[model samples]
Target chain A: MSGAFYLATRYMRRHRGKTAVMVAAVTLTLLLPLAVTVLVRAYDRQLGERAAATPMVVGAAGNRYDLVLQALYFRAGRVGTVPASLADDAERDGMAVGIPLHVRYTAQDAPVVGTDLAEYAAFRGLTVAEGDWPRMLGQAVLGHDAAERLGLGPGDTLTTDQQNLYNLARNMPLRLRVVGVLAPTHSPDDRAVFVSLRTCWLIGGHGHGHAPEIHDDEALHRAARLAVEVTEDNVDSFHFHGDMDALPLSAVIVLPDSDKSRTILTARFNQATPGVQALDPPTVMDELMGLVFRVKRFFDANFALVLLATGLLLGLVVTLSLKLRTAERRTLHLLGCGRWLIVQTQAIELGLVLGLSAALACGLAGALTLLAPRWLGV
Target chain B: MIELTDVRFRYDASASGAFELRVDRLALGAGSRTAVVGPSGSGKTTLLHLIAGILTPVQGRVVVNQEELGGLPDAQRRRARLRSMGMVFQDIQLLDYLSVRDNILLPYRLGGGLVLDREAKDRAESLANRVGLGDKLGRAIDKLSQGERQRVAICRALIARPELLLADEPTSALDADTARATLNLVFELAEETGTTLVVLTHDPSVLERFDRVVHVDGGGVS
Candidate 1:
């Protein structure tokens, strides 16, 4: 090491409390902007990539943000649901494939997404890590994280979280068995549980596995009292009493083969089509991210202001440090130390602090970049 | 080894006050021990400072080892001080950040006609050992007791092996026994090194061992 560096290190080590304070100050100063830039950029990439992967989404004509979040993230909320027939209508066009999604409930604090098994799995590039996909009512296919988090696998049964305490008329919680777990895709799908649309209806109390002919009041009351868990003997007894087309679906993921077909289909479900809207997921997500980016920009401005203030504070700290070392400096001066050496010692100490803070800031930026999506759910 | 002729000094802009000092001609032979005795505010410290080249006199020549200190520039004067003289002040000015060994070797590290080498380290170790600081050489200044720190200060002052060793109120803070022991050690080290000793002390009982005594009061040195 250089002479100045050696002396500076010795001095800093001797005055550990003051050195630690300075290091902490510089680290915090560098961390703010570095973390903000990394997390914001990562957030933008996560949103943009998820939206771009899915070409378009069809949902009830209400909150666009809720629709995008539901179709892409499988997040359950109170958004309106359109009829499942819309998926058939979208499929009838023959230019696009419609995959139905019904997300209106959760199990074990994780969203339970109801979708067509083959289409959803193929669209998501899901490869089963264990067991088969859910094919029967009350059976579930878990994502990688969902399975790990719930600690349940094939043949293990779990009950859905209660939906409402005040309303008994709505869907009561249903017991579901885990049938499969998908491999990780590094997407929101990794945190959701999947089931077939028919199973979802059964869980919602719209369908049940009971004898079609209720011969007595006890049998009728038993059937009416609770939703049925699908079994081999009663699977044929499961049925929805209402019109099949009127069953609720949250959204339909449509992949159009051509741009013309996409434009046509999107225009078909205009404002004129009440309770339904079709648009590009990427475009909608872009608008949502735009709002978020504006807020980030504001934060970036505030961060710059903080940087200026911290810079001034550090300048003051340097000055105070020099002043505090005046006695040592004078002793060195009287002992034949060159005055320039004294100044260089302080500069070297400052350089070491800046170097360490820069290294720590880069490490924090890397951690935020790698872990923000997982931790913050971007 | 020391000479002063009509040395006059003023610490303030005004020339005539308690701070002004005028020393008439004074000379000390080589290897001589001199005690500078004075009351408080008698400019005894100022006289020592002048002779040591720490402060420049306004109007006379102060020579040490035949080099006129007032004739040299500030940098050369500092080199002369490092190469020729050692001083132990009343307040022990040991750098607490450094170990006792580093503090003793500081003169060589300052690099004015001195280089830190095996010879220098050996000399420091020997002086520390002679002054009963052998085990404390690697210890920090704060870890040492008052008597131990005083001995370290003496070791640091003598590590360069200068021709002239100056002590300013060395044992004023110690007990009577420690004070006598510290002085006897300083005297013994001076005799062994053959360095001319100039001790400034307020205690008159300590003056018995000196060959010459100079008293200062009322801005005049006699």
Candidate 2:
């Protein structure tokens, strides 16, 4: 056995180029399916965990997938919003604890999610890792990756990206001071910036504040061009117009106290409630992931075909290689090598190549698995 | 010592045509250097193969060192050839992938009958040194000159310290001077190891160096 090993190793080393080509071919053939399988599994695990944790979402009666995506992942794509009054009404009706979410804005390209941090952060298990939560208007807390991406810590300020860079009549961007950084949740939260709902409303041009010296008229006109920055001196002066009940919320996360409450709430909000629909996030996620996996099934069949073709080609290559080594085999035979020993030597050479290829394929698949969630922006 | 009596050998008649070798009697004493001279198609290589037990005679006895090779099974005959006999080929069939040192120690790796210990390695190195290839022991076979390759083959044959050494046109691929030099090295090594040497060649100029000469023609040896 040792003799066979030595001979096999020497032959492989001497013909390293051919050996490397073989190894690379087998590694790539194995890696394609392995990487996809690992990455999709990681994606399924992360999306399932997050969806399973949040029970329900309430939004404007429209595409349920968009509503759930905005509520769970803070994805921005003009998913119509429900009135903010729904959260208050749901709370007052004793149906569930409703936390309003406004996700129509961004700061430094990261989603700026507006909610009552006291309730929303606790509901989502978010804790400040660096400083404090956003306690005042114009103060914001950064998620872990958000702070790292923006290169900001406590006391640093960030300005929201203007909705339309060419439009001058719209509300100028709001500059919010970074009051804290949140611990990593490894979810969409890690990529979001959190602020109070009032701050979110202010950024949406619903309200503004002025210096006491400037009259309200001039300040109102100047608010369109000048960026808004809320400070201790001017925070008390800021207020809103219009019916507060009609303010828009992207979605609301509802936490029912009991299973009966959940049943009652789903029935009332989905059917009896006007202009609103309630949805179970896990069901919606399952539907969405079902489509994803259906597409993966096609890929799996395609991969099977590719693996078969590669295996055939590899067999052909091994056969040709053996044919080329006929003279060498004859030499060994004349040197008193038995038929079994010659076959053993060739088998060992092939085994070494496959072993190395398997190790490489595993390493590449592992790396892709670890990075898949972040790549999909889970 | 080697002996052959009434040996009749032939390949498959249908596949290989009418090639046959018939020898009534031939004997080679121990430590004697004998040369078999023949034409291109005169069965010189077959004679070497029969003596080395690589070919089984259809009829007759081939006994080497008092053991009859024709009576042994395939595996035992192969073991006996590996342990007691060494062979050098016309093409100096050294594996191109191996360095000179590995090529010399190939017998130990090809069959498990001999253990390739430090002693085997030292002897291989000493044999290579005797053939003027000590410094180039790590060189690839393709990198060596034709004369040097022949010297490596000689070292490989002597590495097992076999009782008998067979050469099939060993120096055929070399020039006259290198061939003479290579033949001299083979004779010197065989004498030093007390190995019975039988060389097959068609080059008559080198016949004088052997103790006796046998000629094969028209499928018969004299």
Whole-structure CA lDDT of model 2:
0.90
By DockQ, the best candidate is 2
The digit string of per-residue lDDT tens for model 1 on A208-240 reads: 655556568778577465434666667787788
State how far residue A322 of model 2 sits from its true place (Å).
1.0
lDDT of each: 0.84, 0.90
Q: Candidate 2 DockQ category?
A: medium
Error of 2 at B29 (Å): 1.0
lDDT of 2 by residue, B1-222 (tens): 799999999876635478889999999999999999988878888889999889989999999999999999878888888888888999888999999999999999977489889999999989988888889989999999999998998888888899999999998899999999999998998998899999998788888989999999978999
Those runs of model 1 whose alpha carbons end farther than 4 Å from true positions after fitting are: A1-4, A166-170, A211-228, A308-325, B1-9, B13-30, B57-84, B108-123, B216-222
Q: Please state the CAPRI-style docking class of candidate 1.
A: acceptable
lDDT of 1 by residue, B1-222 (tens): 899999899878535543788988989888999999989888888888888887899999899999999998877877877777888878767788889998888777665677777999999999998988888888988999888888888888888888998888999888888888999999999999999999999888978899999999977989
Residue A365, candidate 1: Cα error in Å is 2.6
